[model samples]
Target chain A: MWVALSYACWGISIVLALWMLYDWFKIDTTYSEEMLTSSREGELEAVSEKHRI
Target chain B: MTIAAEPAVQVQGDRVSLLRVLGPAHVWALGVGIVLVGEFTGWNFAADKGGALAALIVCWIVGLLYTSVAMIDSEVTSTVAAAGGQYAQAKHIVGPLMAFNVALFLVFAYTMLEVSDAILLGDTIVAKAGVEGLNHNSFIAATIVVLAWLNYRGVLMTLNVNFVITAIAYVSIVILFLSVSPWTQGAVLKLNELVTPGNALPYGWIGVIAAFQFGIWYYLGIEGTTQAAEEVRSPARSLPYGTMAGMITLLIAAAMTWYVCASLMPWEYLGITYYPLWDAGKLTGSALLENLLFIATLLAALASANGCINDAARAWFSLGRDRYLPTWFSAVHPKYRTPYRSILFLLPIALAFAFIADLNQAITFSILSGVLQYTFMSINIIMFRKKWPLGSIRRGYTHPFHPLPAIVLFCLCVVTFFAIFLGFGSQLIAMVAFYFLISLWFHFYRYKFVRRGAQFTMPWPKPQGY
Candidate 1:
């Protein structure tokens, strides 16, 4: 039973890996300068107010 | 045919310029790394302290927690995509002091791992050549030069190495599994569940805790991918997805290796040998299979060495850029665009440590810092949403359950970190803690590097001067 379950997990992981691999190739490769100009950019907050210079 | 990035200052405002050619797949490959050597060899050590089942249970827990952390980390990648990567995330959420700590940990861990990889390569080469008294240092130096050259060439070439190394590694692992079908008719495939007097669980529960220290090694370097987040093409999309995908691949590799090794050999026996998979192939399979695994071990180490160099430079680049270190540390080669100087800076340190430091001690120190880095990532998540809020930070894929993943991962990481340090004898932990305090003192008091805003890239719509 334990062996079966371990195999099952491995199976799921393999399938997920294949999916990731497929997506890895299909996803766009070019750097998107537009991404910088489209999202909210200026409302920046320091990570920690206590430590910020 | 080519989509050129907009002018550096126009889009990024001048303080940024890494050629972002890496896509999601490249990022994913980098994330999975060459192989989880721990899962392949070192994890059995954990089984000595924790029963086989106990070791397996601890691995499951650690793996699942890391998956959660990755999910949360993806959110970080989406929000603040910078060359600084996780250190930047920590900077944005925790402050430069904590970022400084995390950065040092990453730098130390990567350099230390590279040392081990180089020594392991030397050992493997001597064995393969069947040559006595091979000058190991020369071979190690040659390997470092090759690794450094690949990285110095730029991200695309370094990435190209990742593609070839990772493919060979995966193929080798497949070959190993096929050599002996532990899931089926292999003679050693039985459960060996006789829990009578001297069963697999001899040390009982105490053993499980011991086993986990090694078990965590399986997924140790996956987070190094986060270092590459800055160089990805569409980091917002690729970083989150790539990281999670990498984690899943490692999980599968870990499970397959654990099942095969545990089923085929006595857990105690597996712990003693350095090359568990290579040893497995020797005992049960043909000579050809044993040779393949021997080659696999070297190839995997090569992949890891290459990965460490690239990521460590980026981490160093981040520190240099932020003025935490000397400015020259982050200086880019005019032609390569890669941080050539930073890579060089790490090489000497890596060489020194590789020759002098014990391999086990190197791995242990690397793990200690790795766990702390993970804990810092979780803390970044907990503070990130609050620092930027919903409207301020763009949502690529928000991790479900808000802070649950962060909280859970933080607990697991800290406990593991403490346990491993304690195992090294409390004095080592004390020294590390003391170093931590000294760094904190330096950062809060004597450290004088002020932030000179660079053309930092944030995942927001409108470009802002960083």
Candidate 2:
């Protein structure tokens, strides 16, 4: 029973990992390099905003 | 196309960045969480080499090493304000070649540490439960997976969890210290154990030098807090306070751990025992302390693994973003605003190390890689100050007694390499050769992919000496 639970955990991780890879491919195919690396969001936020508590 | 100097407000819809949501508290959590595991185990090997007193002295000596590390890192990281921490600093201060090596060091250091933590977490659970046929790999995979998912979702949630678990593990050490009642004049401790001449320095002064390598286990990953620079809301304010606070916390915790364990047990036994805190707790004959120490051990591994996942992914992400590696790994999650691909990509590599690499080898690699970074940091800071003098560019937090700390850190790193050689001579030589081969690959093949001008992201003026 304990062995089964451990395998179950691995199974969940495999599924999650696959989902991430799928998302990765989808985004890669959808966006151009110009759009993807155009500007860093943190730099933009740094200019005018501070995180509110 | 060049990255614009002006803030690109219009690109927010298409090109996302990591969320700038972390505060100093989270920064403290990230640094302390990665290091608190050392307080649980791996440090007592020093006691085995030199003796309890020697281990304590080496611990302070290593504390100085990491203090210099934290000081240099805080000053640079605050000004750089990038995700890759030392790698980013290398790119701006040094050049692409050094940056490539720093990235490799960051990735391997955290990834291997993560692997060690996961394996330990799995083994600890199985050992504690008295399970006969449980697969340790399954628990290891799950620990990595869940933490990666949390990291993939967002930095805030990942570090928030780190804060809670790291705090619990830290408090457990304090509980053990108080329960022993060290202030009550040897209530539960065998004070005589400390003064036994044979027990204090059995192997002589040579043993003290040998003990220096394991002393690194006391504060291995505290400098990792700087990896969160880009995500932090206020780098200038947060990095210095968080990094220094984390250092002070580790110093106290390390001393407390040594005091409690060294006072309760003879150095000969304490040196060879795995999980010295747990053993010390058992010596008190209190089931409550023993069980709590067990739980604390488990939590420390979990916390360290979580922070490792966070740090390793960020370094990989920064590398990708700058085209140091393939650009495909650079994408941020559109909605989650996290480096989802980088997090998932490092998952398999960490798992591979966890299963195939010997735990001791993995840890040695991690320590050696960290020492390489510290050695370079001393050089990096001196260059930083020389190229960009005090008033040349603004600094978030400047370390005092300029050049002294850098000199001390460099000297300590050289000493540590000798200590490592005295014990694991072959591993030391192999690590140097491995890095050498990879540096060649980056120079010969990978440099073409990187955009040289765009790589210097900081808006500072041309360097002074340049």
Candidate 3:
């Protein structure tokens, strides 16, 4: 019975992991554009400040 | 409002290099946990019981050859730094048809492998728990769904989990080896058995070759570290280093595990059962040890399965991005930054195979498809060297011998392909037929349907300064 439960748990864990991965990917891809643009702006600002020095 | 000229908007590429995305330890963990266990268990089984010393020698040679080819692959990636890795290289140096074929084979192979790993995990759990009449199919199906869910979350989460799981797996192997050590009654042959011939090649040279071919399946995802190159920090250096480091770590772990297994049990006893490692653990005379080993195997399989899903989803994303398949596959979730569509697309395929196919059939199909893809990638290295010559300075890692190992791997791949057909029977034929039909469908879809009377040309980038 323990073995059976282990098998079930193992199966369930994988399904849970997959669901989690999906949600993670969804979040990453959705915000990527905004994140990329903001990061670029920050870099440009840093570059301009360095040149002013 | 004055109609002033709009401020120039500078757009920077959001793409990440492969090295920046991967830490050395993360790469090491993946190499040890994900690649090693997946390749080693079955490899040692074939080497010790099925092919004997000849098989072991052949595999070592193959391993070295594979390592060399991987080095060449690093050079290719460094030069192009393209998203698709092998697929991109094949298309650029060869043609779209070849790239499409390689991509399709890779996706199918990895998908089958993920299901197979899940099934093996289920089996290990069942064995340890001493469970009878377990529905293997349902268990596998459930596991596939779980794996899909994990990957759907994102790469970072998967990697983080993989790191923990890999640590557990290493500990398990160590405990298993130590636990089983007391069982040796001076009966375990050491150096002598390395060369001693027995039923190891039960079916003679043909069988030995076939076993070694199947054994190569264990090493299937070693190149996967390269897949994450876009995320790594300094891909030119790190990609090659990470890849080689991962391979070396896996080789050591595998050799250690195999040596321990060989030292603990008689070859004859090892050959009698499929779950030999678990059996060895049971000989420790401690129920707790048995349970621990079982849990460890499950964790190893889980980590491997998770890694496989991540690799497969990314490959699918690359395929879609390159317009090789439907554009929807390239769809990243607006919020998640993940290839949401591709992950969703792969779940059903993996789950269907897990539930529908028998375990052995699924494993055989996965191995055969993997061998086919590896063959192409190995050959592509040699082809690239000749077609696109490097200048005086070697930028990235170069293969030690210019074309020798690559040539040998190519030959080995061909031998393995034929051997798989002979050993695997009808499934081999079905897989080949499936791949060819998929290729034809893609070709037609691209030329006749999607392009619709437009001329089909190579998807080559315009030369700089043109």
lDDT of 1 by residue, B66-155 (tens): 787789878876767776567877776666677778788888778877877777776666656665455466557656666776786677
Clashes of each: 13, 0, 47
Q: Residues A21-52, candidate 3: write the lDDT tens digits.
A: 66655555654544322221012222322221
Every candidate's lDDT: 0.67, 0.85, 0.60
Model 2: which residue pairs collide?
Answer: none
Residue-level lDDT of model 2, residues B1-466, one tens digit each, is 1111322232354556666778898999999999998888778889987899888999999999999999999898888888889999999999998988998899988998998888877877777668777768888888888888888877878888899999999999999999888886467887674648756888898888888888998999998998998878789989999999999999999999998898888888888776788888899999999999999998999999999999999899888888889887787776566777789899989988898876667778888889899999999999999989888889999999889999999999998988898888898899889989988998999888888787887889999867
Q: After superposition, which runs of candidate 3 have C-alpha atoms over 4 Å from their true positions?
A: A1-53, B1-20, B39-41, B44-51, B137-142, B174-201, B266-269, B286-289, B392-394, B447-466
- Model 2 chain B — which ten-residue stretch has the worst lDDT? B1-10
Ordering by lDDT: 2, 1, 3
By DockQ: ranked, best first: 2, 3, 1
**Which structure among the candidates has the greatest TM-score?**
2
> How closely does chain A match the true chain A in each prediction, as TM-score?
0.50, 0.69, 0.55
For B1-466, candidate 3 gives per-residue lDDT tens digits of 1122212222234431111234555555554555655532455545543545434554565576567656767676665444445665676666677878877766776777787777787666566556566655655656667666655544555576788888887777776656544345344325345334564455677666666654564466776665564444455677777677777766655555655655555655554445555665676567887677677767777777777777677677767655667655665443233565677778878877776775566667767776776778677776666655555334566667767767777877777776676666577788788888877887767633333112122233432232
Residue A13 of model 3 has an lDDT of 58
